[model samples]
Target: MNGESAMPPLPEIGDLAARQLVEGTLAPIVVLDADLCHLYVNPAWGKVSGLPASAFLGRTLGEVLPDLQRPDDVLRDVLRDGQPREATISGTTGVCSPLGQRLWRAVYHRVELPGQGTCLCGIGVEISSLRRYLDDLETAHQRLALLDAAATRVGTTLDIETTCQELVDLLAPSLTDLAAVAIVEEEFTGAPPPPPGFLRLRKTRGVAPPGMEWLLRQLGGPGPYVDVPRGIATRHCLDTGRPWLGNLASDELFQKVTVDPERTRLFRAAGVHSLLIAPLITPSRPVGVILLGRAGASQPFNDDDLVTIQALADRAALSIDSARRYSYEHTMALELQRALLSEPRTPHPAVEVAARYLPSGRSVLVGGDWYDSIPLPDSHTLLVMGDVMGHGFQAAVAMSQYRSLLRTIAASGAGVDKILGEFDRQVAQLGLDRLATCLLAVMDPGAGTCTAASAGHLPPARVRPDSDVEVLWLPAGPPIGTGLGGYESLTVRMDPGTTLLLYTDGLVERRDTDIDTSVQALETLSLPADGPLDDMLDTLLARLANGAYEDDVAILAARQRDAHD
Candidate 1:
């Protein structure tokens, strides 16, 4: 009856104490005995795995789970080495229960229980929500990269077809592991309110199969397929103006609505698990859609992937829109300049006039350089070439204005110097902010007379009908508003069958090189007067434009034929 006997030797509950500590105190409690029986499981484990305590208790671990017996398995090492193992379990689906599905993230630990020897325990945590959060973060990062690339590509190029192709190029490699782009018109029905649809397979990455056109044609009507109801990313994008993904294998909306089961099956056979479709949306509506596919045993793409693709599609749309605008403005600028550059009524019947404009190779900006051969009423011709400061629309506007002013002065029969004086006054009074260089030449047919003036502009080159090239570098004056002086005329005689070449400075100026060198180069490259006027001009341009000029060049070449020749 000593103190130990009075306390009944503490009941030898060391093992029970350890088990209680695991079951009640740990975050996700699990207990197992030497015989591989699960003796206890806590609420956290049941909540995570959606399994009850009864599911784990009194069961042989190996009999319940086959992965445990494999030597290379993660759990087996923890048991043999008596070490706690941490690993992410892949290829396991979430557990479904009445209350809702919960995903299990399992952690297995090996423990030694006194008298019970070695045991294996597992603690599970619910991480379904966390997994979704991480997925979202990944998707956002991808979207940002796509947008940045799209913006860079679109901002630099202005050719619509090339820009469109670039967009497809960007998408092809990322989505389908190949480059492909297609453009198609949206279909509209007049009667019976049929489902909306769009064109397909206007273009593709690589060569499309033979029946692609026919297949696309057949896609409009009812058919079993995983595409949106309207058969286009355009339709959905137009309707929603938001990014969307159609999961072929799992989406009930797709399954219920699709008509072409064979096409769906064919896609699956080709290893395309799903389609991530993004709309090429202009602000008005969706013009096209870029379709991306995960093919060849690749896991189906997730929402994040769809988002990135959507961002790229947006940039493609914007680029196309901008290119169209710029092209329209350019055409209009050319047309306006042409309207101002009307041909004068030719007095001499044998004289033929021709001109050409060559764009600079390095810049997309259109220039204000222009040429006009205005036939005077007095059996003569007024040949003019001028270049306004800057290029593009503004220069074009100035060129149009100058053309009007020159025509007005020529109609009044003023001398070249007097006409230039009037222009200087008009330019300064209008405060136009634009400066220009101009050269004007008036030739009398019967008189064999030529009088030319320069306003800081390149002088014309004379080619005798017999094909002798002579560059005329007359005394130059200050530019139109140079404040130093107005222009003066220089006189020359034009023998019968004379040819005069008036050109903008851009025709003779080369970057980082002397004007004389460029002029000499031009002289060396001029074509003989044998072909048609258009052909001769083309040859001259081909020779001059070697992909180096930074400004537009305008040329007006006049050849006055002899009375008999």
Candidate 2:
């Protein structure tokens, strides 16, 4: 903006002194004529370029370093305007470095010598190493971002197939053009690796661009893929516990393993040029393989990519193993509950018994809650519902013991209050530590009445034939195993066709809400009184729970039929 110089120009120096100073500096200096052809070069230029000064003199950059990009226009502008240009960056090729190239940041200015007119002088220094370090930092940042995504994206559900799907969804189009996760069939997580011949894999999920769909189809689609023996790429990943990267065109092991005709044709047709495979190994053993493929014009898989791919795969593998263990425990707990909850036996044709056990959609849903129907003396039917405190295998086992004891005690035709009092003493004597809530009622057909009692349990609802539903006023006692039994019973005469509903607290309890509020809410709802016993119970659950329950539910509904009907 100003015509005046920012500072005074350097004092004039002798020609010999200027030449010596230029030659002695480590920076490479070169002078070019107005035509941009090299006019002179210092000795430092020879050492930097690994060529004599004559190689640059009198020649254009195109003639000397044809592969390197030259900023000819910038130099011409400097020679015309007499202004200085500083820190112009460029890359040079065919240099004497190990990489056969170097990066340079240079300064250019217009200069006049005695015999020559105005020309451009450039002073440059190599910056290839610094540029490489910066590039490495950027690459590392991108890799960290990907790994961070894998933590949240993978294994949000505790299911084996779902975990497999999450892994492929995270990798495809990011690490490769195509990706798939194949789990070894029958190879449970945390188990030892199976023998090679028995290694058959089932592909759980494959992801790719829509255009690449045909490629996945041609490669036998999802499987039960053909059994891969020891030399195959997937087999290599399993055997070595390391990633395998290969080019389909020239990798010897890959070609030998995929010698079949259909695969060979598919790879060629799909333009799939490269592949990277990593084993999904948990701490115990290899569970599956991550298949990443690059097709058509995509860069081939390299070792640097292997590190990121394997890290993501490892994260997914650990989560999958955790899910598998949880599923196993859930199944075991549910099986134990099922064995204890066989169909309730109706004492006589006069009474109808309908029960439902709805476990919530979680691993803990298998624990605690249970119901049963037992026959008593004098053709009476005993209805029961209970929930052991806490959840899991231990709670399930405790519940089974409680249900078994109740069945044995009810056989003696004891009244509900006396039976519960006996239950408290027996469980306390048995050293059952977990508290349990229970409701027991006996429907006496001959007497036309239902008598019930509770042990820290919810009240039973009586749905009259006219649709008048009310939770009976049953006295409460400490939960079983409290050993402070002060039990009481309430009897209500039931008209024929009236239904009695018994349930566990899971049917109404919710977080942050008063238990009485939830119970009163249930009482306000209109029940399907005239419908079949099963339909009425279903309607009750649909209206009350509505898929929002976090705990298991056990409900039993009983109605006494008219003697003729």
Please report the candidate that would top TM-score against the real structure.
2
lDDT of 1 by residue, 1-565 (tens): 0101111112232366754454454355556665556666666545444556676678754444433321226666788787787655322223454323334466778876555567666765656567767766876676677677777765466666687767766665555443233443332234233334522323322212333333333333333222345643435554677755655455443343234444554454454456565667787755555655555555667665666666677777777667666666666655655665555445356566678776665555666887777777777778788888887768877877877777777776777877777777777777888888888888877788788888888878887666667777777777765444567898888887667788887777877998877776655654666445566667777767656566777888777666777
Clashing pairs in 1: 172-178, 180-205, 223-259, 223-260, 224-259, 224-260, 225-259, 225-260
Q: Please give, for residues 1-565, the per-residue lDDT of candidate 2 as tens digits.
A: 0111111122322455875687678887877778887777767666665666667667887787776777877787787788898655455544457543477889998887655667787899878888888888998998899899888889888888888788888887778899877776664455455556757776677888877777665564443454667677777888889887777565454454352544766666677878777899988887888878888888887776888998998999898778777777777766767886767775577788889886766554457887888878788888898999987767888888898898888888889999999999999999989999999998999999999999999999999887778889689999999899999999999888889999887788888999888877766877878779989988888877655477888899999877887
Each candidate structure's count of clashing pairs: 8, 0
lDDT of each: 0.62, 0.79
10 residues in a row with least lDDT, candidate 1 = 1-10
Looking at model 2, residue 126 earns an lDDT score of 79
